[model samples]
Target: MSPTKTSVAELSGNGQLVYGCDYNPEQWDPAVWQEDVRLMKEAGVNLVAVNIFGWAELEPSPGTYSFERLDQVLDLLHANGIGANLGTGTSSTPAWLTTLHPEILPESAAGVRAWPGGRQAWCPSSPRYREYALRLVDEVARRYGTHPGVRLWHVSNELGCHNALCYCDVSAAAFRTWLTARYGTLDALNSAWGTAFWSQRYSAWEQILPPRITVSTNNPTQLLDFHRFSSDELLGYYQAEADVLGKHSSIPVTTNFMVAAHIRNQDYWAWAPHMDIIANDHYLDHRLEDPTVELAFAADATRGLAQGQPWLLMEHSTSAVNWQPRNIAKAPGQMLRNSLTHLARGADGLCFFQWRASVQGSEKFHSAMLPHAGTDSRVWREVKELGHILEKLAGVAGTTVKAEAALVFSWEAWWAYDQESHPSSDVRYMDQVHSLYKALWENGITVDIVAPGSDLSGYKLALVPGLYLVREQESAALADFVGSGGHAVVTYFSGIVDENDTVLTGGYPGAFRDLLGVRSEEFLPMPPGQLLPLDTGATAALWAEALRLEGAEAKASFIEGHLTGTPAVTRNRYGAGNAWYIGTVLDPQALRDVVAGAAAEAGVAVQVTAAGLEVIARSDAEHTYTFLINHSDDEHKYPAPGYELIAGEEVSTAVVIPAGTVRVVRSFSSAPPTTGRISGLKDDESD
Candidate 1:
């Protein structure tokens, strides 16, 4: 079948920032619908996500359905010139279906089936569940496929967020079938799994099952395959629904992904191709850490998933979420900053989780565009102001964010690194990856989160950290990238194993041993809080590797330890470029120093040198738009002068951007000019 083809502009109300929230009219009375429409029009909301979790309302009983309420909401939105992102409402099943067929419920690893109290209670691999879910989806699509008010079709909401893995018998049967297709025979499965290690070889296809609770620990290979199977099962369900929607609807279809570090089960790289437009839901971790840097990482990753196309910010919170332990509301102006940040990266649309605050539910305390305090509250005021800003910044809808640096992030590697029996239980994959990404982020460098198969020709530097598992083809790709004049920086625990989690035979860092020009004698996994001295007057902690130079030169050595006088860092020159190896975790200052030096050698410019300011550039064929956001508490000065896009004021000298504020400047020069007036603000000229 041909791919689902639809432009993002068509989905966003003719190329404006689709500003709206999840609207559940069924939750409120019919009289309240008028107020909802008035408040939405006042805030400049042009799109509304309707009936996301309305299975209980749409289908109250088997073969019995009702669309009286949804029809009214759709008519009301269309009359007000607002578009609707229609939801199939199959995220949760009705209570009657689950009660009649209890086998549809998923079971945990301990063999206990979940009760039908929460959402996502059905097993994805169950045949009965798929049959019923698709029936409802077909009805929804047929009813509103050709409606003029419908802009897009939103499939199931946040797939695999809660029920990613099911250890029921149904899932086991599906897993066996999947393995048969992958391995072709039991002998091949035995060899790939290395079953000879513990006398745990399988002789028949019927012997396989999901990795349940064992006496001690399950086999690592078995667990890895289970993770892969679980992700595929959820993707299968999404594809089934997308097929139904494609048969009747011409609008784009998308399902939001929980694209945060907290969610690791779904491989978004594999899931991206199935979406006509990639959408993500992100939430800040309220643990006193700065969320702006991590938010940048997530945005870049989402852009990469879109393959440089503009994606959608499907769901984000205006304030604190009620689900957290201590829910603290966002400070003033933070809502505006957060919304602009995603747009500055590559988002074509900005949306919140909810439109109005709920009166009674589990998420009643969750803040929305319209809080319970009417339009007089702080959240509501900020929401209205942000909507106006989005209307003005419509020029940024179709442009692409440009980044010269790329970070190699592998979901397969993340899964392998998280398994048991590693060098150190303290080594967190994302923590190390964030160390490199945060360093560049602090230095005002924009980066793209590239995976193993991503195109690397456009980037100047590629940073790989905590890549414990690497395929042979992936190794060859990185080698070709560096040989073709791309600089690379590789960290420890990379290239040690293949796709099957099998260690390489020759030495440590097997695949990249030649490219990085270093070989490890032994791994020095240190305890927490213990620091090892380095030659650069910096301290290394958490883990270290005793290294010897092969075709590389040592950059730093351990001062005191069993690996004293040994190389802790090395650099090697290849055909047209160079590769640097970081054998140990460097201090924050040392990391910044090394990365800045390498980037300068590669002729990569640092747009903003100030510590507290962030500058992201997005461009079309004509103009480059620079977004200068001050994330710190103190005021910072921007050196160059440009025309501020928002205020339409010419900045001839340095301007002071206050705390939690944003300034977008348009630059006309093809090459970055040192200092000049940014003149292009007209719509025709900017594009």
Candidate 2:
């Protein structure tokens, strides 16, 4: 069965905002279940994700099952107005199952099998594990198939969190089989992997093993393929469980994804189509000097993963999370700001990790809807207020964010660009992408994060940051997009390699050279603390390409460096439009200038360029909802006058968005929302 692209709220038993948290009734005594539901009603939680990590409780002994406690929990939730986002308890393997069938456990890269105590300890290719998982899912679906309280079927708790890759013998066999299916023959595999370079030729399928830690550096292509295989292996598990649940129940099936820059195990673009509605688990990187920008980036990227379909915010923190070294509590209104930010980016449902704080567990320190301090805490107050706000903003459910610009974000490129053998070890993919994204974000120029194959028709300008891996079709699409009057910015290190991690040999950037109209022979990397001056006054640092313009005119040139007279940035008039090639990593201000200039050329306006405010726009057929959120400690004035949604007043002037507050304004719209999605961009647009 294929997954349908339906809205979660529509598919949900109730059509209200899905305000909920992860409910673990098994963690506390069954006596506490009633109190939990009572508190849930007070907080306006309509849905609760139940039994996510309850594998041991569901199957205490091998082939022996008990749903007694879960039954009571479900009944109590149903007795109240709350419904269950039912989870199949397959996230963790029961100790009994591991004790009886230890072969199901996953082996790490060092070839040591993970212990049974941790969650996600099973290998993806283990037949016994799959057999046990399918049985558990079948039982859960059969019992909850027609239950009024069951709103959706959750396949597993964060897929590929721990055991994303296993270098076990089972995985080795599976990898060989996958290679055979992909390459068809050993000769094809050898040619694609470029085995002749290191005399690492494979004569037979059995010779290939996972690119584990070798004596020196393992083959880069082999490691890249292994990353692809590992991601696909984890995705295969999700597909299998989802297929089983689909067969047994009518509820929409989904798995929560940790869709952030830190979690790189699964390529969610491939995993998104398998889910009925995209659901993500995002935790702010507290280590970041400011985590708000990171949060916005994740939300935008997740919205892109949904292909414009409304997704669910499966989990976010109420305050500090348990895993970070310094778990700082959120300030008074910061929690409300965080949740609404996701809503502004197209999240139809807002939920968190656990419903109540755990007194004793690995996640005991993690904050919940009702924290460890009970219901009297500020966290609880904010939770109640956010729930009320979501209830009131029901009309924002099906609306979509519109942007004349897009930032190209590819997971395959992320994997390829960050490999060990890159030209410069200092090059980080996400940092570069964020530099451009943050620049546009600060300018209030909303951008949709798009993959290589996504539609470029709606977006007048597309920004490609460090696209290290370029597929054949992807290159052609960009070329076609430019030839037909679409402006683009192809940054440094883009179009260097193919889908198989093979370099395009003629010049530095292979397929994009013609479109960009530049040729580079060598890379000039600056030492730490060194900056190369550009004509734009903003310095370039970390990386500089020795660029020679072909058909393009030099927009900016390096003022100092070995290639001091060479072009640092070039602009080419391709067909009806133009493409800008930034040959080096520019400083923040320089990137902003370059991007802003391109955006201006494309007629994309910078709505708000304030320091601390984040402005995003969502639209329907008649009205545009512009959200002005103040992330800074100081107050910010709203630059435009419109009817404020939260304040319920018309602000003609002097509208100050308070610190850590969000103000959504409903104003008249002249244009409709952008039509079609990145996935459906191949369909021609009349406009």
Candidate 3:
């Protein structure tokens, strides 16, 4: 069978302002149903996500069903002309099912069997759990699959949130099966895991155990496999739910993914092809974060996973979330500006976390459309205004934006870092990746965050920061990428391990040592308040690596430290391309210079040249759409002329913009035709 091709119309066919929020009428009185529908219409709400946590209400007992309340909820929504993103209500199993089949409860990483109370408490690998959960989904789909109000199928709520790294008996059995499929024999498994080191060779399948306690201390190979198994176990659950839902309903199906979610190993990327559309929730502590960085990360994650297809911003707080240490209300106009930011970054739909404020539970204090106080509040007014504006700009929904550069992120690298007994505790994988991304965004470079397996032909430069683990297969693929004349930047701790998280026997950076052209003998973690002098007559800190040149020339070296004469950075040429290796976590200024130098050498071009302003573009054969976002809190003026998509106006030099504002622009030219010169008119000589 041919794969389904998703397009602008198919993604946004439901119409503009596909406004939706999670609704639970099960907590409200049936008499108030009509009032809720009236409130929805008044706010211009067109879609409602229902039955998210309705397991307790729908199936209170084994083989027993109740649909009176659910029927009224769906009927009222359909009668009001509102569409529904119908949920399967299998996120949390009912108490009765848990009491009957105790095996359904999940086991924690520490090997403790948890009782069924909180959400996502079920053991995903248990057959009994799967049987009961699949039956419930089938039952729900049979009843509501063709309901007039249902427009999309929400498979499960925020999957892999709780009990992510389960190592229960059921999971243990499945892990062995997974291992058998991957490695054909015990000798193959033993060889892959390097089990001879600790005399931990597995003589039988039963001898192999999930990495819970023994694997963490005895073998990094087993621990890495355990991580892989845990990710696949959760993915199996998601796929099972999708299979059941797809069997009955042809409507688009999706599950919300979290930003930089580590528990699942880019399994969402693998699942993207099976989904009708992708959706995710973005929650950041505004006090500690630059809004630009947070939004850029969210958009890049979604765009990367969907391969440039517009995704849904399924959940965002209307005002303040209760979980942060200090729950502060959004500054006036902040929410509105952020909503526009999402659309400019290629979001097709906008939805909040909730419709009505909850009166009970962990999220009761979170902000919602209608605050608990009632509809006359400022929060409600802001929401209504946003709804109106979204309704007006509905035509822009499903539009594609263009991008120029891409960043390569690998799950194997993530696993590699987690498994490695790092030389320093401060060498964090995600933090390093984020640091590079922040720099790129600040320089107005459009970036696409991509997985290791993705094709690298479209991008001119691919940045791989902190790639500690380079799988054998990936090494060949990356070799081909660089061989075809692509530019790649790799940093410290990269190429240190293989797919099994086993250290490469030859040197520090195993397969890539030749590509990077440096052989490192030791890594020195710079203590706080310490500095290392570089060959460029610059100082850097945080950490440093001492290396001897093999083929590449040193770009920088330490100056003040005991290992002052060591190489801190190096570059090597291979095939038709080159690789740059940064050996330490340098300060922002040094990193900026290194990245700029690499981009210059690669001849990569960016859409904009302003600091703190990000320009991303997307195109087909005919036209290209560009997104210009002012990520800083201070006002900025543009120095070039471009047509704005949202305002339908032209901007030239001296065009002023407030903080957090976004401008969408369009162009007709193809790749790099106007590389050096600004197209049309100069900033000073416009119109």
Considering lDDT, where higher is better, how would the candidates rank from best to worst? Answer: 1, 2, 3
Candidates in descending TM-score order = 1, 2, 3
Worst 10 residues of 2 by lDDT: 678-687
Clashing residue pair totals per candidate (backbone < 3 A): 0, 0, 10
The better-scoring model by TM-score among 1 and 3 is 1
When 1 and 3 are scored with lDDT, the better candidate is 1
Q: Give the Cα lDDT of each candidate.
A: 0.83, 0.82, 0.73
What count of clashes does model 2 give?
Answer: 0
Residue pairs in collision within model 1: none
- Mind sharing the TM-score for model 3? 0.91
Lowest summed lDDT across 10 adjacent residues in model 3 is found at 672-681
Q: Which prediction has the highest lDDT against the true structure?
A: 1
* Segments in model 1 whose C-alpha atoms lie over 4 Å from true places: 1-5, 672-687
* TM-score of every model versus the real structure: 0.96, 0.95, 0.91
Q: What is the lDDT of residue 436 in candidate 3?
A: 83
